[model samples]
Target: MAKRKGTVFGVPVVVALFFLGMMMPTSVGISLGGLRLSVYRVVLLVMFLPMLITLFSGRCGKPHLFDALALGHAALALVSLIHWGGLQQGLESGGIYIVEFAGAYLLGRLYIRSSEDFRALARAYVVTVVGMLAFTIPEALTSVHILHDGIAAVTGGAPAPYIDQRMGLERTFGPFDHPILYGVFSASAFSLAYFVLAEKRLTNGRGMALVLGVALATFLSASGGPYVVLMMQAFVAGWERVMGRLPTRWKLLWALFAVIYACIDLFSNRTPFHVFVTYFTFSTVSAYNRILLFEFGTAEVARHPWLGVGLGDWVRPVWMSDSMDNFWLLIAMRYGLPAWALLVGLMLGLVWAVGRRKGLPEPWKRARHAWAFTLFGITVAAATVHLWNALFVLFLFLIGSGAWLYDARLPKRIGQPPRLGPPAPRLRPPPERLF
Candidate 1:
């Protein structure tokens, strides 16, 4: 809690470095499309320097399940790269991929070892949401994206990459590649704000105001992606209230309702997947492209079931299909189905770990709800939008940190430390959990 330069080696400093790197701005920038290697990446590399030192000095511990999954995903990407892009190109691209995404997870796993440490990151996210508003609010009202202008000024790129007019208004993209992605980023930050600023946790009135401000900023982003994510968060909140606390008959009634809905979708020839396609059709171009990409990309993944195509290879199949906006399909098309499976397995595992109804304490239960919402938001947004570099890495970082928290709060026998490096005991008694 001490805000001083001398405390840079502690957990709080991790938050400092992350936000500094994220907000480093493109005024001193470089833009190679999504792979822009600019000051932000440079600062992340610097922030990562200490972790690299610790890791190489034999100070790190055994790999957690999520860590292993990340390593597997990285290795698979490398193999896919070598097959599709050649060994040299693979090394270059795959090296960057691993360093940015996998390295983020590694830092979280080794350094952010507890809920307190994770809160440091959450606090930084809440602050970044406010900082983003300084730019985004202007963009929304006056239709000027300052960060976009700065990127153009420094890198000689387009004035604003993904700006578009829809329904008589200009979509304000802020610092992200697209308007929806900006909304998704805001939505993610809003989830972090909920954890960092619970109702009674902050005495000042700013906590409530900040939460509302994030919600407004998210709404003003004028994109459906974040709206869907917000709905998911609301669903999680409502579910938390009645999920395990409900009587068996009430739970059965909800289950029957779900079954009836599924049956309706099936019999009416509107499958669940079709429901997503219909519900996510907020923008014609993005929705059409997503459907086209999903249809073509799935076939491509089937074609090359193991090591999939190079990043640019699938573009020749359909005109303007250069970007697979959905992250899961992107992975399946480029790396292979295995990578997708591994990534999804890790996320689902986190959801299950947190949703366990056993003697979950108040704090851990809240962590579970927040983390589940994080996973749900990420999953929903990834299906409609794409993020780049530091932003994308931040997604992977949360996945790792959530997994770590789930492991840290697992119930243990009296006098034993919380579970670590082992699977949850199948037959242990309901035990206490940490807040």
Candidate 2:
């Protein structure tokens, strides 16, 4: 197959629509049979069939372990929903859940089939975050969510309120429902923007400027979770660049963390995780509540391990709010440990799988590094905060998008001789190139 000519708008229609839909709040959705079909949900559902068809066409490549895990997670969610809510309501809600989860995954799997496609995705990601600054900046300064407030004015729905101030600035919610969600979504593009764009295409400091733009947007949210994500991305990027020469650098890094964790667990008054939660947070109260939440939340998961409290409240102190801040724990508390495991497994498994692949050109190598590290940041951040709606779908979409890296084989040179092995399967041709 000839080298694919990936354009900036390679996945133009769906990618554009996906980001555009996300810019609108959930309040701006159509009501169909008691189900509020949000903007992004509609986009996913509309494209779900075509994406599914493309996936099964063997166009991308043979399915991998993550593919099975994604489908299995969706299936478990459907079954759990039915088991909890009676057949009609269960199917209604569960179907949307599948659409959000599996549908988003398939879109990423089908559209991003090569390094060029991945590049296009990365550029789109950075562009989207940069464009979001117009509203986020004003929202951060004014403490008024401009986008949501405007939508609420017309739709007669309540606008998103200003979150608690951090560092004397109101947390910027941007177009998302929460400031943390906005920050998490924006922070994801940090590694991609820096590694993919700044490292190669925009080497003249313009790329670094773009990365700072993304960083500024993430900071505007002023949320702990997003800050953690930003810090992790920076750490990963630095570690890889400085330690790329050492073969056992990763193992050494792991051992170092292990030793630190052991020392903290043994010597500190609080457990390692508790200490981690306490120090990483902006507010002492939040840290304390999160610790308490983990304590109570895990107990609830233990009580209802099979099918979690299913839209029902988990047991906690009367003074504590019903919200579960931790996304990973919330999954176990709501859907059961199996569901949480499958979802997490799909994420970390793909990151590990793609990271292990070798012999790629600079672009592909950076692409893998960017995607893997981005997920690493999100994985740790999720422990500190919950993701929902657009952010949740986006999280899965990113995981699916990286699936291409596992099977990708970019030519080392223009006319490199074929390797001594069975011929690699031909990649499905990309769609018409669009800038």
Candidate 3:
């Protein structure tokens, strides 16, 4: 078998473009005189499309499990478009989310061709996150400028005067449009960083220092839901390591802790230290909020059991009196039960594939393990926040990359060897002619 040659520029270029796309300022919209382009949409065009072309042109290999997952998402998007209405309404609103997710999956499939590529991508992610945190930490401590802007943006237009009066201290939002979102994004990144650092020995002191900075960022972000999700992921990882098994008294203990924590958070207005300790000591309010939102969303699902009340319409003012934070609810509201079912099946299938392919080689196996837990954390986190965004897309790339790494290691099916025969025996006459 021929060994694969690594491209000097391709992978790094893709990683850089992706990180830039995520970090680019959306406020300064891409513009040409009267016309303005969204940074995100442009990012999709510049980063993802060329990469797809490269993959197909290179005949990289057959599509792997993550490819299958993208197909499933795309299929669901297409179905929603056809059944619910045309592209403008269905695709533009609800369908766009799926498209972005598929884009992430495609990018992941294209860039992650080998275990080394997977590791490199992970390192890039860690670096990008740490950089963001480095900027945010100083901003968080010195002034409330970032938080004020985030609140204003999240509220849509200017925030109400009363909102400022009520909160007293300014909320800390970091770089994101909302504080909660900032927290969620930071938590996921921090958790992944932890996993990456833990898996490999950090021989380089600089790498270890960066990981520590990321951990601090996670702690300070203070978004309740993601923090809880990270804790849960840590517990799951620890449990997986200990006893070499899942399902035991420890699971029960964790569940009980979660329930108790939620009860306390809901009923009490404790001090910051108390809240922090209680939140971690038990299940927490974040979990309870998810349950409530999911319930509320399900009730709406019952109303429109078949086709949903149009994409984006469910969250509109007329549909419900309150916000629906749960991801399942969001899906059910946009695409109805059938689409929701397809999504669930896709996620479950991915989880099963990761679990079944546990014995794959290094970096690949480690990546798969990280992805499985990451996805689990994502699922839990999504119950309290939207998972269809640029950050989530970045995450999908990591997951798809892991799947591709696994596929790369698998033995090829039986096939005939190349038919080029040994060089024809050199004749004495030929040798004399050469002389």
Candidate 4:
């Protein structure tokens, strides 16, 4: 494959739309036939039409395990919706699952085809973070949500006011629907920027600046989820150093031990993800409520067995506790264990794939590993935050890119065979006039 030049009007356009769309209401784009369309909804609609065209037309990227997994998830969501006696709602959710999640996933696979391409997309994402900070930082100091108010003035829905005081400081939700969602958005952006640096894709000073800038922007979003992510980023180097020194046998032993620990916890009525809930929560009370949320979550899974409680309002685990604060659990509770397992299997497959990629320089391998690290952190952090809007789309996007990287045979230039093989023999018309 030839090196690619990123285009503003191409794949990055989707990110641009996502960047702007989250600030406004669905009514801003269209209000017709009980369907409220926001910029993102419109973008998804437009993109999916072309995306589906390419997919069926055989002009898209190669499919992978995650692609099938995503489809299964959508199928489960549709079934749950229909089973709960909401055929109309089922139709609505089925459309979103297909067009929103699956569409974005394929788009990532089709467009982000190389490391350079990923770098371009990451640059665009960093710019989006700058825009988000422009709104949030002012809100933090002024105690006013100018960006929200401005969007509401035109979009015609009340802006979500999920802001709060926590950790003795005000939290800013910015363009996202909630503070925790905001954290996920910024944290993911920071992860991308960090990847650029770890890959040595950027000059030392510039890379350092970009990483810091993106990290600081997450702080401006002012949510503890981002705070935890940043902390993890800071420790990644140290952890890598310590872990890299272990013998292969020890690594295998550690993996076995972790599996055993998880099993013991599972039988004792606790699951592994709850560990994140305990550590990342804002308070002990909030942490305890999450326990209640999980108990409620698992029970719903038990009752529904296959389809789950349906795409209604989250079964309120307790009064004023509508938020599940965990994406994976919400899927299990609403869609079923099969859906949840597919998502987990996809994530774990990415970890194994990214780490095992061959024929790359150490820096390139480390760069990809950096992405895996953050992905793991984000998956764990989901126990503390919920997925929504652009953030959720981006999560699927990562899964798409990850799936690609996992098995991509690393494209080779037309004339250059990759790495080591005797050079293609220089052929010439045999000594003068053999012809």
Candidate 5:
């Protein structure tokens, strides 16, 4: 609440630090007892107790379905890991994963208490993305990652090397571990900035500029996953603006999508998903790899449906790489179906609950719109690419941040507005006398 240098634009100091820590290179960390302590992890550790206190104190309102699902997903992940690896290794890996997932979610749930708080978060996200442009622009031009190099040099860890080139330019990963991750992080801010920080209109120059800044950062990643997220959010936002007056626009859009999907399935040899992958990627090889990932990954899930293979290597062709690009498939293959179900349920349920709420203030409505748009984009993008580490945690955090809206109170009407002309005569003022 204090106006201090550490807390900028009403964002709490802890949240500000968390944003900073997230942008730190992955190599900037220390190892303890075989567990890594990265900067953001340390911040989470510092805030974990406070998050627990606030969560249990009833200040954040009753725990929602998504909250329980988040915890259950993490717990199941831990149990699944322990089932595969021995308890010792499992505890190490799974404990860290739990801390990353639930910790981030609870922190968001605790700190963001109102629509104004969410606007502060939007400001933080926009500022973070715009500031990173200083480094991203250089990285995009020179094909060098100064943050990775500088952090690695200080920490004596190996710097992340340049990944494959696209469009004759090196992918600009910025401070994230991968180009896709960086893109996702940057792309996540588009709707938040446009809808929360600026007026939602083409004429709102500042809002348009903020969203454009986020898009630029997303584009620098040069990865299909980020492109999908940015473009999806843009499409949804545009639809909301253009078709806003049509009450059943969303239903109409879904109907159209279903028709197209049915036609694709009926007429084409390839499934709709396969067609999507083949056409929506930066390269055919990438699309082909994702197709194989989907096929083999789902097979593995079917083979071990209850508790999945955990950390063990999944069975795939010798030529096929071990890495999976599909987030949903990877979850089912790694943890199990239940874990995937809980997570998916949480996401969709949150979206449904928030969208169903009535009488929220106009600002709260916009906040809900922004949050939903961002989540929908990320959710769709995850099918084409996997999320891990910071991006994964950030997704859960954003979800938690929006959960406040479900319980948000409608704005109280103080009184009717004053009449501009002379007050209405006898009818209003002489009721008792007339009676």
Candidate 6:
């Protein structure tokens, strides 16, 4: 066999494979004994095999801090096990969380190299989401008919599961387990597509068309989190644009003032604000459960403020409730303050990186802005739902990758040109002078 030369495009290809794998149906295969393996899982395993082989063969770069994030998550799980009581429960809950995040970290590190790689990955994600939405919209509309037929065929009866009051409007789950997951996925996809369209280098009529289609899908999903994210993204992008026209000092001051106001507002209106969110934003079940879970989680934090109830032990008495809806509360209940601090630190670091490099090349800037919007959206969504799943993990990876890229391309000084030297000589030197 000949030695293969590694190509630059391999990164994006790997990323695309991972995203496609994730988006595949979970029930696309059969169960072998107790382990239920799906086509999607099998494909991801196969795709990962090559990357593993390449890594062992010294063809890939060493893992960076992004990979460390996965390890940190694992460490938090370990800590939870020690604090809670047993490893079994931790393995069941926190273990799954760790695996999801590890997978996301590995995927992000696998394909991200240059700004072009980022764009390609983002494009692939957008295409997959839009394509899924296009295929599923009609299916969702006709789900009642399809469900009726399916039920009749199985039971040979007139009454069907579709007509049963248990199931609401047949929501198109696509490859995911629920319509809410689809909604979150669409929201992130919509944001990324918008960013792609906004980028000067990548924007076109095609991109705009895709963005509009994805936005419609997001609206249809009726997932309030994504909508909130969209609004926040718009505000941030607009703010950035306005900041660009102002002096650097004024920009800094404006940012500081905004932060101060946000802090004040957040503290002053926590109860009524949360009430408004519950009333207006979430599904009835989600809103009710989230409130209960948040209360339980907060109490758990108060009791075990130091080590937490133990990582993955949030389901225990103090922290245990029927509803484990909020991601932040989940973190607080499972990992305690230290783990929560680490997660918050990571998020803040990403935000700082994005804010610092507000002015960059087109795709790079868009990537950062999109990431900021996604994170903010995820945070809001987390209040109503757990973000330990594939969608949230992917969103985190995107934000991290964007921050990494932005920092990689940051200008050397606050407002100075990247290079301090005089412009390159326009005329070429004579061959003799080249010596």
Alpha-carbon deviation at 307 in model 4, angstroms: 0.9
Give candidate 1 regions above 4 Å deviation. 1-11, 24-36, 43-61, 151-158, 166-169, 199-205, 242-244, 247-261, 315-320, 357-361, 409-435
Judged by whole-model lDDT over C-alpha atoms, candidate 4 comes out at 0.67
What TM-score should be assigned to candidate 4?
0.82
Model 5, C-alpha of 134: deviation from truth (Å):
2.0
lDDT of 6 by residue, 64-161 (tens): 45345546765775667655767665555554455445445545545465566666666766777777665567656666334224334464434322
Q: What are the per-residue Cα lDDT tens digits for candidate 4 across 297-416?
A: 777788777777776665553465677766777888887888778778777876776766677755356557556766766776676666776667777777776554665556554586
Clashing pairs in 6: 80-311
**Pairs that collide, model 2:** none
TM-score of each: 0.80, 0.91, 0.70, 0.82, 0.92, 0.72
Q: After superposition, how far is residue 156 of candidate 6 from its true place, in Å?
A: 20
Clashes of each: 0, 0, 5, 0, 0, 1
Candidate 5 differs from the real structure by a C-alpha RMSD in angstroms, to one decimal, of: 4.4
lDDT digits (tens) for residues 301-370 of candidate 2:
9998988877777788799998888999988888888998999898888877777777777788888888
The local distance difference test score of each candidate is 0.67, 0.85, 0.58, 0.67, 0.86, 0.59
Question: What ranking of all candidate models by TM-score puts the best one first?
Answer: 5, 2, 4, 1, 6, 3
Model 1, range 62-135, lDDT digits (tens) per residue?
44565667778888888888888788888878877777777676666666656556566566566667767787
Give the least accurate 10-residue stretch of model 5, judged by summed lDDT: 426-435
Q: Report the C-alpha displacement of residue 30, candidate 5, in angstroms.
A: 1.2
Q: Cα deviation of 417 in candidate 1 (Å)?
A: 18
lDDT of 2 at 388: 87
Model 4 regions more than 4 Å off: 1-6, 9-11, 22-28, 56-58, 160-162, 198-203, 241-276, 312-320, 361-367, 411-435
lDDT, model 5? 0.86
lDDT of 3: 0.58
Q: How close to the true structure is residue 430 of candidate 5, measured as C-alpha lDDT?
A: 42
Per-residue alpha-carbon lDDT of model 5 for 1-435, expressed as tens digits? 545454567887777777777877777877897788888899888887778777778887876677889989999999999999989988988988888888988877777878778988898788889888998888888888877676778878777775888777778877777888899999999999888877697788888888899999999899999999998999999899889999898898789889999999999999999999998898898999999999999999999998899989998889989988998898999999999999899889988988888778778989999999999999999999988878887888898888888775666665968569987667555455654
